[model samples]
Target: MSTTTPPTHPQRAGLHRILIVGGGAGGLELATRLANTVGRRGLSEVTLVDRYPTHFWKPLLHEAASGHRDPASHHIEYAALARRHGFHFVQGELEALDRSECLATVGPILDLNGNDVLPRRLLRYDSLVLAVGSVTNFFNVPGAERYALPLENVKHAEEFRQKLLTACIRANHLREAGAALPEPTVNINVIGAGATGVELSAALRNAINLLSTYRLNSLEPERDVRVRLIEGGPRILPALDQRVSAQTHARLAGLHVDVLTATPVSEVRADSIVTVTGTELASDITVWAAGVAGPPLLKALDGVELNRQGQVLVDKTLQTLSDPRIFAFGDCAACPSSIVGVFLPPRAQVAHQQAVYLSQSFLRRLTGKRVDRFTFRDAGTVVSLGRAGALYQGDFGLGLRSLIVGGRAASGLYAFVYRRHLFALAGLTRMAIETVSQWLRARIRPSIKLH
Candidate 1:
């Protein structure tokens, strides 16, 4: 590892050195917010570290995987964002942490061909934030890690898209040549019927329909493509209201996506999946959206307490139990919920709220004022169903009781949530311009990414 320090603005005395690791939703927003506030005011030296150079919203990965959304259009470059927001951006992975010295070790920068561009180096910090987010949890299921594709990052989504396209083309060619095939259709098995899996299934069906209509003319989408959403729970979207689940399940059925609930997958093979009931189903492609656990990198944090799910144990203030200077949030930190004996769910809303709270908390910290405990306010949940529309559940101003909404109103609300994220990051002007640009692009470009 090289001993040279990564390029950053020289730190000035009396400025609080705040280091935030992980450029996901929470980390990036916090960096942008604090950079615009305290960093701009010369009160703190804000630095954001991340493994990747660009930031893409995780909630949109499923849409990218289904080829319904183009990731390049939405990804934000850290360097450019930092320049505009007045924060130092460090491009490297956080490998280890030393609380006593208040330092973080970032791994070396590596090129695509496996050569090191820069050696591992240490970053000094007065305060540290870990928002590295979660990773796919296979739960020790046999052959799952090897056979299933995960949607943890942009690369994974693109890989799934390319493979889906290739499979469709190959199947169409076979049909056109009158060749005998082992299976009648190209089967796509999506494990777990959470928001990700359900949305992906719906998007996949829409993509297949568009592909058949435009590109793969020889193959009929209904006859040649099969999308299956398998879940272990009694119903899809088990976390949401049962009414929402029932409506979503019915809509998926109308879209011809087979929804299998209460059927846990015991094993995932290269060409098939074996259920706990000893049933084997053919699968050309499999996506694992089963569950997520805290990233394993948290283990390297010296003496930090971790729960069984590998999440960092933090108090209401979002500070680690072992170290007050070290903080964590988003999906990586297990913060207590309002309900007794339960922790907050790993949702984007939780992360966004924590980020907003942290920005204010930091401002208060600079003034030597009391830092407020973070509280989560549920804005509700919306699941996209592509062109078929969307389903929304949660308090929609109906006195805290959940309201179920469907069709265009629900779809518009679903879109507004994403726009809100953009608004938070880029402000009103840029967000509005971007929204209009994307709308215009949709008119000119194909509904699905062709290449």
Candidate 2:
């Protein structure tokens, strides 16, 4: 194994080094935009470091989990993206930080067989940005970590998809063998009424319908497959308006999803979920999408001040409270909101806007100009309901009420949000090309991944 200390890249010696950790929606966009401006003019050397070699949008992980979207087709390699956008890509996890020395220690990269692929290295940076994102917050529920699957990344999504497929196939074989079967041969319980849980439950129902029609003709989707959504709150989407929540619940009913509000999970077993009310629900697959908190790495960030949720605390300028040279944003940072004592919500739009704002702030810094405070404009929320439809509530600025939209038009708006993210990373020409390619591929390939 090899060890290296600082000076990781061979760039211009006098240029300022900007190191960004994490390649989520916000980090990648900031890297691309900054590379086009400051990095292009040789004012600073930009480098993006991520544990994964590829990036997949976190918002769409639910679709991947339900097999509605293929992970491989949508994944963007960091190396290729770096070459196109004029930035450097480093694949490593940030393990330690030294605020006094302005240095970060990255852990070693290992292969599947536990062999070393890359040695531990140190990266020196003039400015560091942390966007490492969040992880599932189990809240200390008994057996949740061991039994419930969390849709935090691509691997978890794919694992859930495969297990779902296996459960369906196994049930079909049991029926063929003339064995006595229980009601709802396959039971899937998703604990959470948030956007991820709601969207995933709908997607799973749709996938099951398609599978019964196309492949598992012997199995009846409605009679044999059950999808249950459990929420501790009084209603689903507790964060949104009451009208929006009511509309979404009705739409879910149309898709035959069982929504259990005010039902808190007490324990998760390998084959069952126990609620706080002492009700035991038999579950073939259990998904935890209830909540998220900052990753454990944030706790180790060299005296960085974090909130109760383990998210780094940042001021209006998005810089960490402990050090000005270090910054945080997206799901990892608890950025102050316009409302007193409230942090911004963890949404893709919020991150996208923050990325744009940070890029401009960096450019202004070089000119010795003042950096303005970051403000987030409410852009509304959109929820996907598979092929049935979607619900969208638009936030009208000022004192005007929000606009509620439903059906196909709402679905189109949902698609546009993802395309807009792509446009930020790649220019319009490439984004358009990617759009056309996905359209073509959908026509040729199976709707769901068989494997």
Report the lDDT tens digits of candidate 1 across residue range 152-270.
Answer: 99999999999999999999999999987655579999999999999999999999989988799988887888899999999999999999999999999999999999999999999
lDDT of 2 at 229: 96
Candidate 2: tens digits of C-alpha lDDT, residues 137-236: 9999999989999999999999999999999988878877877898789999999999999999999999998787778877888888999999999999
Which runs in model 1 stand beyond 4 Å of their true positions?
Answer: 1-8, 396-400
**Model 1 steric clash total:** 1
CA lDDT scores, all candidates in order:
0.92, 0.92
Query: So what's the TM-score on candidate 2?
Result: 0.98
Candidate No. with top TM-score: 2
Cα error, residue 432 of model 1, in Å, equals 1.4
Worst 10 residues of 2 by lDDT: 1-10
